[model samples]
Target: MTILQVGALPVRKSRGGFEILLISSRETGRWVIPKGWPSKRLSDPDAAAREAKQEAGVTGKISRVPVGSYRYRKKTVEHIRVLTVTCYVLWVKKERKRWREQDQRTRVWFSQEDAVKKVREPGLKILIASLEVRPKS
Candidate 1:
């Protein structure tokens, strides 16, 4: 069975353009977006927002609709499990100086093209590349 996860594609408008935020994985230190299993009390987008806050140290407005989904294999003690993560675009409002996983993960902002190159997952790269950024009014 595939496990479901929620993710936040944290973004902010820069002088040149929009930038995407990526965090290092706790175990492998690989670049990845903030993601976690679904929360019973929160909706998918809300859960994604929570993950972003804990992992990336950013809080923002999350889209009600999902941006996309990606499949990845997660390594566990017993075996590898396939997980499908639903992603939501978060228009970053605030970045905290400290967060829950601050010590475990490093967060970095990159241009859309750079973010696509930084992530390992093919699907995630496509999502980042295809994201449409509207000018902040």
Candidate 2:
């Protein structure tokens, strides 16, 4: 069966306008949005919000509905599984001094254009690119 994941494209209003938060993958250290496997107890949007807090040290208002989806191959010990991630927009309200994965990952905030360039996944890149034109309110 295909694996399902939830993710948050965390955005916050900045002096310039808006910025997106990107975190490095623990294994590859590539730029990515905060994401993880779906939680059995939490709704998708809430799960995405939990991931954002754990992975990026930010808290915010999460959209009730996903803004988009992306597919990627994830390699496990024995096999590679296709992961379909549903992405929600998180309008950041607070940033913490530390987070759960702070030591295991690096998090940075970038402009939408730069974030699109930094992320490796093609589908995710397209999603970030779309934000330039249709920014979250």
Candidate 3:
């Protein structure tokens, strides 16, 4: 079975306009939106928020609808095509110190254009496009 993961498209407004927060994996150095595997019992949005807190150290409200989906191959999956993820919108409310202190994740903020371009997957690109990104207050 393909693993389903959830992510938060955390956005902030730069002087130029809206921008999304992205992180580079310490393991692979791949730039990706903040996310993690969904645990049983937690609702979808709850999972998104939890991922943001664990991965990015941000607390926020998540969107009701899933933004989009992506598929990737994992090492264990030789014959079965697995590794699917759903992107969700996370509206940042409170940021904690752990994010600034984290050494494993290389975090950066990007303008919508740069963000969309930097994202590795086409499905995630679609999620960024479909991002009903609200203006940061």
Task: Write down the TM-score of every candidate.
Answer: 0.96, 0.92, 0.83
Q: lDDT (0-100) at residue 113 of candidate 2?
A: 85
Model 1 Cα lDDT, one tens digit per residue, 1-137: 77999999999998878999999999999899999989999999999999999999999899999989998888999999989999999999999999999999999999999999999988898889898878466
User: Residue 134 CA error for candidate 1 (Å)?
Assistant: 1.0
lDDT per residue for candidate 2 within 1-137, as digits (tens), equals 97889999999877667899999999999999999978889999999999999999999899998889999888899989889999999998899998998999998999988999999999999998886423446
Candidate 3, position 83, lDDT: 76
What is the per-residue lDDT of model 3 for residues 21-121, given as tens digits with 9 covering 90 to 100?
88886568777877777878898778987877777778777888887778765454356556788877787778787764267887787878787888777
List the candidates ranked by lDDT, beginning with the highest: 1, 2, 3
| Model 2 worst lDDT window (10 residues) | 128-137
Model 1's lDDT to the true fold? Answer: 0.93
Higher-lDDT candidate of 1 and 2: 1
As for candidate 1, its clashing pairs are none
Clashing residue pair totals per candidate (backbone < 3 A): 0, 0, 0
Give all candidates' CA lDDT scores: 0.93, 0.90, 0.76
Q: Which ranges of candidate 2 are over 4 A from the true structure?
A: 132-137
